[model samples]
Target chain A: MALFGSLFCRLVLGLVIAFLFLPILIVLTVSFSSSAVFAFPPPGFSLRWYASLGKADSMLQAVWLSTQIAALSTAISLVLGTLCAIAITRGMIPGAKAVATFMASPLMLPGLVLGIAFLQAARDFGLRDTYSTLLIAHVVITMPFIMRTVLASLSLFDFAMVDAARMLGRSYPAALWTVLVPNILPGFVSGGLFAFIASFDNYPVSIFLVDVRTKTLPIQLLNQVEMSPDPTVAAISALLILGTIAALIVCDRLVGLKRMASI
Target chain B: MTLARDDLAVMPAAAPARWTFDAKALIAVPGLVFMALAFAVPVLMLVGDSFVDRDGFSLAGYRKVLGDPYYIGIIGNSLQLACITTAVCLAVGYPAAWALARIRGAWQVILFALIFLPLTVSIVVKTFGLTIMMRRDGIINFLLVNLGFIERPMRLVFTEFSLYFGMVNVFLPFMILPLYSVMRMLDPRLLDASASLGAGPVHTFLRVTLPLTMPGIIAGGTLVFSISVAAYVTPGLLVGDRFMTMSQVMAKAYLNIRDFQLGASMAVIMLVISAALILASSYLVRTPGGERR
Candidate 1:
């Protein structure tokens, strides 16, 4: 009976994994097809679509814009989120738990709601600049990721080392800079990486904020798919998959995947 | 004696003054202010806008949304879809999560990575992949035809099935991760104890394991349900003009029609529903388990 039970569990796990991976595998396969159309099981294979990526100027510009917003927002959120996390974890404020929950609440809220709210707020406040509006909205989107990971890291951290540094003649600021920062560096790297990716690939929230000349990569790619329905979008998907894998590897090296998942 | 007393008073004053900086609180101010201005205020304004219009404070927006069967039906459909998607995720994810919790070592790492990979990639990319597969001449139809199941390609792209399939693919990880986290921390001794008492595996699971893991189930369910309800990209891309979710409608209200009041009202509804569901689930988890560690 136990053997049979175990076998059933294994079968379920296997099938679920296949379901999760099959679409991505199909995309990868389709990216290398020689055909211009989206036919499965292409007649032959070639890298021509990837080479043709250069002709898509808007897609390239979207990529650059997305990278800039992601990098900037991640950097901003890292510093702000880390400070807030420290305050919460160290019990320096009353109602820290409530604050922490509020900070991370965006993760649970739907991006579409946030998107419309930001649009309304931007219009109401007379914030006409699309780039700044996008950046601000993305900061809200990315802060929760940074706060969660940083808060988790800080909870595991021992602040006695900072006090020790202080007692050893360092100023309080100097102590935190020298001791606390190094210990939580893994959290920063992982948190920042997640934040960057969250902003980079964000679609729902970004779809509303983007203007005629300021489309993000996901929106741009969606537009391309709607317009062309060709291998060019497949090629972009392949590259993004590659980029995500690279980021995961770096995250694993810095902080084990187990820790990342737990957060 | 007088001199010594003055020195003691001065020392107390110096100590309080030195401790007044509150470095931590000072550090937190910037982030708190930012969230308040950017996130909290915007959402509040959205809710506030729902109750007002050009004629001043009114329920016109809410009335329009609730009174009209079209909008009412869309909300009903969104809820129904979310319910079905959550149920499917829980049914399939429970076993998979259990298996993940039981395993260890390299296989665990690889399987977890496999689940996590799609999550990290763009949802557009994943949905696009599904679009390709579900197309008339896509792999699924091609296989079905070649294998003699059908004489020709069938229309599968813009169907409810494809929408559900796309959503389930996108959200399964959310369900599995939460459940797995809880299951991993479950103590093994309780199962052993139940077995020693001659309880069958089924009985043990129903009486002990299931109750204990209810928190995980609630958490995962809430996550899946809320996300599924508010989903726009998958439904938009997959179904296109065939169906309209509240989110897609809300997007159109804001972007195309320039109806901020209607859009804000819809956005407010989604937020309130999501918040209520989360609170209800958390309450359930808390009351039954009484705060499980």
Candidate 2:
């Protein structure tokens, strides 16, 4: 009975995973097809479609812009978010609890609302269509990940070691460098990965703030998917899926998804 | 104890005269400053924009959104869609979480990995995948047609069914995670206690396990409800604007019509509804310390 039940569970779970990933697998397969239209079991496989992607300069530019934005936004968010996390987690402020809740408010707001609000705010400052507009918007969206993970790590941590280091005459910077940094590195890295991906895949804010030159990958993909149902979109999507999976695996290996979930 | 004296001797002469690095003060300064700039300011401006008009503050945009039946209908649809999706998620996810909780170790890791795989993928890409698979000539329809369940292909792609299918698939992990967490903490010896007291398996589940897991159920259900109410992508692509949720309508109001004030009003309404649900669920979560029959 146990054997049968275990097999059943495996089969059901396997089917679910396959269903989750089937379109991505199909997209990759379709990208290699000689045929222009999307179809399973292509007439013959060819690398021409993948090669043709090189000529789609707009798409190429969008991918480049997305990479830049993700990198820049991640950098900015890391600075602000790390400082913010330390302040909230280690502080003895009267309203620290309220401040923690306030920092997490972005996660609850609908994307449409957030995007519209940012667009309006940017316009008031005459900052629309600039790279800084999108970069700032991405930071707001991604900062929550950093704050949430870092706070969780801090809350679960033992402050006794830090006190001992202090009592032993270690400077604040020295203690932080030696003790806190190593302890929190995993959380920060995982959170940073999530932050980058959030910026990379973001469309709601990007669509409102992006210019023709500043489009991110998702906005570019949306444009293509809206205008033309080409298989190359699938190819790009396949690249993104592969990239995201790789990121997750690296994150798991470094910090472990189990730790992330607890946070 | 001797370390306290020895540490005082080694203390740096240039060390500041503060008792310690003020943990509270340190945490507050940066986080509070950043929150004011990035978060509070933007949302406050959003609310302010909703009330202002050509001359000054007015309720015109709010009136426009509230007075229009078409816009009002979207609120009803948003609530209905969220409720139905929450119910379906609970029904499907409860059994799966239950089954997984019964297993352990390497098998447990694999099951968890399967549940979380979808979350790693982009939401837009996932919606696109559903669009392809649920189309008229898609695999699902092809199979159903071949099996003679219907003589002709059914319109599954641009309907509520497809919307629910996409949502349930996308949000399944949210349901499973909370349920799994709660179930893991449940004491299995209680089952033996119930059985020894002459309770059948069904009775044990209803009277014991079900009540114990309500917190997880409530937590997960609230999450699904809040997300579904504000979701635009799945409905926009799959339902194609024929069935509009408040979020979708809000987006259209801003993007298509270029009515920023009206759009902000709709957004404020959506936020209020979500806040109400959160407060209610948190209240439910707190009111009961433990399970009740």
Candidate 3:
């Protein structure tokens, strides 16, 4: 009975995981199919769908735009989040707990709501649907990841090392730059990775804020899925999966899976 | 001469302490500026927009949202859907998280990767895959058909079932992570003690583990609930115009009807409710019934 129970549990778990992932797997297989209409099994295998991606000019543009936005947003999030983490964790703020929650307020709200708010706010500022507008929205949402990871690092950090550096007459900025950042580099890098992925994968915020020229990749994917269900989307999704896998590997190396599990 | 200059610099040590405030100000500068421009100011604008009309602050938007039965139904449906999704996620995620906490070795890495991988993908793409996979000719239907489980494919798309399916899949990781953290911290010897005292595994789990891990349960539940409540794309893409979630309703109000105020009102309501839930959950976790777990 015990063995039976364990087998049943594993089977259920495996099935659920498969259910969650099978769509992308199926899509990737179908993208290589020679048939005009998409199907589960291929009539013949070919690379025509990938070749067709090159022909889809809008997709190419959207991918480019998304890359630019994600890069910029990740950079901004790293800067802001690190600073906020330092401020709150180091007791630079009076009400550190309240301040931390305030910093993470955006997480509680939906992306679509944030997107619309940014859109209306941009209209007011005469920057509607611009790259800067989307960049700002992405920055807001992604900053919390950086803050969370950095905060986790701070919880494990040693203040005595910094005190010793200060006692040796090392300047405050110098102590922080040399002693503090190196120790926390892993968390910072992991946070940056998260920030990049968040910005890249975001759809709801981009949908409201993007224009024809500034449409992000996910937005383009949404448009494509709406108009036509094609295998090229599968190709793009497969590319995204590859990118995510790469990011996960990098994160594991930097922060360790144990730390991530704790997170 | 250099020694004399250094002595002169040392004489002004008092000035350095006075300038320490500048460092504090500098440290505070970046985060404050970013939040103000990107978050606080934008949300404030949405709130402001919700109240104002051509004449001034008016009841026009509120009246339209509240007075219309269709709009009221939309709000009800969104809340109801969110509540159901949250409950289902808790049910599914609790046991899975428990299992993960107990497991070891290669399986742990696989489970961790499996949970985290979905998080890295774009919501649009995930929903798109779900859209295809839940269709009449989709894999689920195909399997059912092949297994002779059903005579005809059920209408799964554009239904609440797909909405819950997608919600549970997307947010299960969130629930699992928290529960796993809490459960791992639990002392296994306590369970052993309970078993030695004639308690069975099920009884020990119910009495000892469940109560002790309630903080994790609350934290994960709140996080999942709030997220599901405000989720737009999954429900929107899966259900389409068949149903209106609060977020989707707000989107349509703003996009299709050109009712900015009404949309803002709905958005504000959703935000307030989500905030309240978070506050309540945090309170529960923090106090844990006025005793530490």
Maximum-DockQ candidate: 1
What are the C-alpha RMSDs, in order, of all predicted structures? 3.3, 3.6, 2.9
* Candidate scoring better on DockQ of 2 and 3: 3
Model 3 lDDT tens row, B136-253: 8777788888899999888888887888888887777788788878887888788879988999768876788788889888988888888888888788888888888788877787
Stretches of candidate 2 off by over 4 Å are A1-15, A40-44, A166-170, B1-28
User: What stretches of model 3 exceed 4 Å from their correct place?
Assistant: A1-8, A163-170, B1-18
- lDDT over C-alpha atoms for residue B152 of model 2: 78
> TM-score ranking from best to worst?
1, 3, 2
CAPRI docking class of candidate 3:
acceptable
The CAPRI category of model 1 is medium
Between candidates 1 and 3, the one scoring higher on lDDT is 1
lDDT on C-alpha atoms for all candidate structures: 0.88, 0.77, 0.78
Better of 1 and 3 by TM-score: 1
Least well predicted 10-residue stretch by lDDT in candidate 1 chain A = A163-172
DockQ of each: 0.57, 0.44, 0.46
Q: Per-prediction TM-score, please? A: 0.95, 0.91, 0.93
A116 in model 1: Cα distance from truth in Å?
1.1
Residue-wise C-alpha lDDT for candidate 2, range B1-293, written one tens digit per residue = 35455447656754432344453356456656766876678878989989998899999988988899977888899999889989988876776776677778888777777677667677777777777777676666777888988887677888888888888877777787888788888888898799899998778878888899999899889988888888877787778778988887777777789888888899899888888999999899888656643
Q: Look at candidate 1 and tell me the lDDT of residue B205.
A: 85
